[model samples]
Target: MNRWKKEFSFILALLIVALLTACGSNGEETNNEQASAETEASEELTIAQINWAENIAVTNMWKVILEDKGYDVTLSLLDMGVTMEALETSELDVSLEIWLPVQDANYLETYEDTINFSESTWFDNAKVGLVVPTYLEDVNSVEDLNEHAELFDGNIVGFDSGAGTMEVTEQLIEDYNLDFELQPSSEPAMLTAIGQAIENEEPIVSPLWSPHSVFSNYDLKFLDDPQNTFGGVEKIHHATRLDFADDYPQISEWFNNWKMDDEEIGELIDYVESAEDPLDGAEKWIDENEELIGEWVK
Candidate 1:
C-alpha cells in the first residue's frame, strides 16, 4: 500500500477506537444513573407504634437519629394487632415497640419472617402487672385483690380498650373471676383517675407500665401477678419490617446498636409527658441525652 493510503487507514483505526471508548463510557454512566435512581426511589421509610408512653418514647428516639441521617421517616400509629399485621404486610416499615414474653407469642411464632426483630436493644425495664399506690400495703398480689375487691371499689382503671396491657389486664380479671370491673378510658383520662386517686391516697388499681413519668412521680407498687399474665419482667424489643435492614442498613445498624439505660429512657419519657405538649417527648429525651446518644449514633 502507498504511504498516503496507510496513513488514512491508521487515522480511521484511531477514530473507531475513540468512538467505541466513548460509547462504552456513556453506557456505563447510564447504567449507574438507573441504579442510583432505583436507590433513591427506595429511600423513604415508614414506622409504626402503639399509643403508650414507652412505645412512643423508644420509637421517636430512633426517629430523631434517623432524621438526623437525612432519612424521610413516616410514623404510623397502630394498636398491637394492627401494628403486627401492617408490619407483616410491609404496610408498615417498623414497629419500635415489641413487649416480649408478653408480646403476642402467636404473631411472633407465625409472622417471624415479615420483619426483623432486633435482639441487641432488648432490655427488661417495663412491668404490666396490677399496680396501686404505695399507701395500700394491703394489696400486694393479684390473689390479695380477691379479698379486697370491695376496698378497691371493685374497679380497675385500664387504658384504651385495644392496648395489649389492657387485654392482659382483662384476662387477669376473667381468670381470677374477680368481682372488680376494669374501666377502660383514654390515656389522659386514665392518668387523671390515677393521679386524682393518688393525690387523695385512695385505693386504686390500674394496668400500668414503666419508662413512665407517672411511675417515677408516684409511690406505686406492682401487685404480684401469680398468674404471670403480664410477664413479670417486661422486655423492650425493637421491631422493623423485613425491608428495613436492606433499605436502611446504616440506620438499622444504629438501631441494633442503640440503647437507653432505664434512667436515660425514663428521663426522656418524663420530658415529653410532663411538658406543655403531651407528646413530642422523644425529641426532648434525645436532646437531653446527646452525650450518651452520640456513642450509639457514631
Candidate 2:
C-alpha cells in the first residue's frame, strides 16, 4: 500500500510539471505575437507636402488619420520639383496633391517610371488660369489682358517662381505678347495682394486654380483662355514610391478609394485656414466626416 501511494504522488507531480510547461510556452508565444504587432503598428511613413492651401489641408488630414491608426507619420514641406525628385528616389513615401495631365504633366513624365500614381484622382474638374475679380468688367478674357494691361498696373500676380503655373504663365506671356510683368510670389502673398485689391475695388490679374478656398471667399472669374495655354480640367492625384504599394497594400488601397467633392474639399480647406493649427482643423473635419473616412479605412 505504501509503495502504491508513493507512485500515485509521483504521477501527480509529473502532470503538474507538464501543465506548467505548456502554460509557459503559450505565454511566451503570446508575448512574441504582441511584440510583432506593436512593431508593425509603430512603423514610420513620410509624406511630402507643398504650401498650397488644398495640399496643406489634405496632407494634414492624412497625417492625423494615419497617426490615429497607429502609424508614425511625418509631413515634409517641399516644392513640387523637390517632391517629385524625392518620390522618384523613394526618399518620400507619398504626396497627397499632384495635379495631373496639365499642371504637373512635366513632372509626371519625368518621374512616371519611378513613381506610382494613385489608381484614381481624389478631386476632378480642377483648372488653372489667369483670374480676375468680378468687378473688372472690361477684362473678360486672356485676349483682353493686353488691351487693358495698363489697368492691371503692368503686372500679372503669380504664385511661386518655380511653380508649374508660373511656367505656363511665362509661356502665356510669350504666346500673347502682352505688355505686362509676371510677379512671382508665394501663394499667401498673392492671396494677400488679391484681398487688398478686391477690398479697394482695384483691377488685378493673377494665376489661380479651382478647388481653392479663394474662389469660395471672393467673387472671381477665370479669364477665357483662347490659347488654352493653361490646359483643360486637371485632376488632383496622390502618388507614392514605386514599391510603396507593395509594402503598404492597405494604405495604397485607402488612397485608391478616396474621393472628395468640391463642397467637401472646400469646407475642409476653410476649416484648416480658420483654425490656428491646421491639424486641429483636420481632426475636426474627420470627426464630422466619420462615415466617409470609414469607407476609406475599412
Candidate 3:
C-alpha cells in the first residue's frame, strides 16, 4: 500500500508539469499573433495629395521614405475641399502641404475639431501677392498695380478661381478700390503668361506664391500688401487625421520633427521639375540629404 501511494503521487506530478508546458506554448502563440496583427495595421498609410507642385514633391518624398521603411502608402489626388472632408471622416491619413495664416484658414476652421496640425514647419517664408518682373521697377506694391492696370491690360492674372489667393485678391480689389479684373486661369497658364511677359519686357502682374519654381526661373517681385490682404510670410505645415498619433505614433513623431527651409524646398522643387520621373528626383534628393532625412524620420 505504501509503494502504490508513492507511485500515484509521482504520476500526478508528471501530469501537472505537462499541463503547464502546454499552457506556456499556447500563450506564446497568442502573443505572437497579436504582435503580427498590430504590425500589419501600422504598415498601411493613406495620404491626401493636392495638385500643387510643392505638395506633389513633399508627398512623393514621404511616400518613398515610408515605403522604404516597409509601409504601404497610397496617395489620393483631391482638391483642398475634398481633402479636408476626407480627413474629417478619417478616410485620409495625412497631408503634408497645409499653408497657414491665410491660405487654409477656412478649411482649417471647418475641420479644426477633427484634425491634428503638426508642431513643426515643413517649409517657411511662403508668400502670396501680385507678382511682376523685376524690370517693372515702378510697380512696387499692390497699390501700384491699381495705378498700372492699363499696363497689365486691366487684368491681374490669377490662379484657380477657387484658390485662396483669388479670394484675397477680391478683398484686395475691394479694399484698394482697384479697377483691375482678376483673370481666372490654371497655375501653368499664369506661369506661362508671366514667362511671355518677361520675354517681351511687357508689364504683367499675377497672383503668385513663393517657394515656386517660377520664382527661381524668373526674376520677379511680390507686390507689398501693406493692407495685409494676402497675409505675410506664411509657413507650410503638416496635417493628419485626429487619430493619427494614436494609430501611427512613429510617423506622427517624424512629422512633428520635420522642418525644411525655403532654399531646401526650392531645390527639391527644381530637382522634381527637372527629373523625367519625380520619384527619381525624390530618391536623389533623399540620398543626397540623408542627414536631414534622418533627422526628420528619427
lDDT of 3 by residue, 1-298 (tens): 9999999999999999999999999999999977864695467889987767787788888888888887899999887778777888898999888778888777777778888876578777888788889999998988887677778888888877766667778888899999888898877788888899899999888887877888778999888888988888898888998988887877887887888888888888777778998888888888899999999887
Rank by lDDT, descending?
2, 3, 1
Q: Encode model 2's per-residue lDDT on 1-298: one tens digit a residue.
A: 9999999999999999999999999999999978865775688999997889999999999999989989899999998888888888989999888787778777777888899877589998899999999998888899998888889888999878867788889989999898999999899999999999999999999999988999888899999999898999888899999998766777888898899999899989999999999999999999999999998887
| Runs in model 1 lying further than 4 Å from the true structure | 1-42, 276-281
Q: What lDDT score belongs to each candidate, Candidate 1 first?
A: 0.76, 0.89, 0.83
Reference-based TM-score of each model: 0.80, 0.86, 0.85
lDDT for residue 289 in candidate 2, whole number 0-100? 98
TM-score of 1: 0.80
lDDT, residue 57, model 2:
96
**Candidate 1 structure quality by residue, lDDT tens digits, 1-298:** 6999999999999999999999999999999977764674458887786777766666676677677766777777777778878887888888777777774554577678776777765456766677899989878888888799888889998878766677778788888888889998877788888899988888889988776778777899988877777776767777777776776666776777666667877777777667665346667767777888887777
- Using TM-score as the measure, what is the rank order of every candidate, best first? 2, 3, 1
Model with the higher lDDT, candidate 1 or 3: 3
Q: Each model's number of backbone clashes?
A: 1, 0, 0
The stretch of ten residues in a row with the least summed lDDT in candidate 2 is: 33-42
Position 275, candidate 2: lDDT: 97
lDDT of 2 at 219: 95
Clash-forming residue pairs, model 2:
none
- Alpha carbon deviation, residue 14, candidate 2 (Å): 27
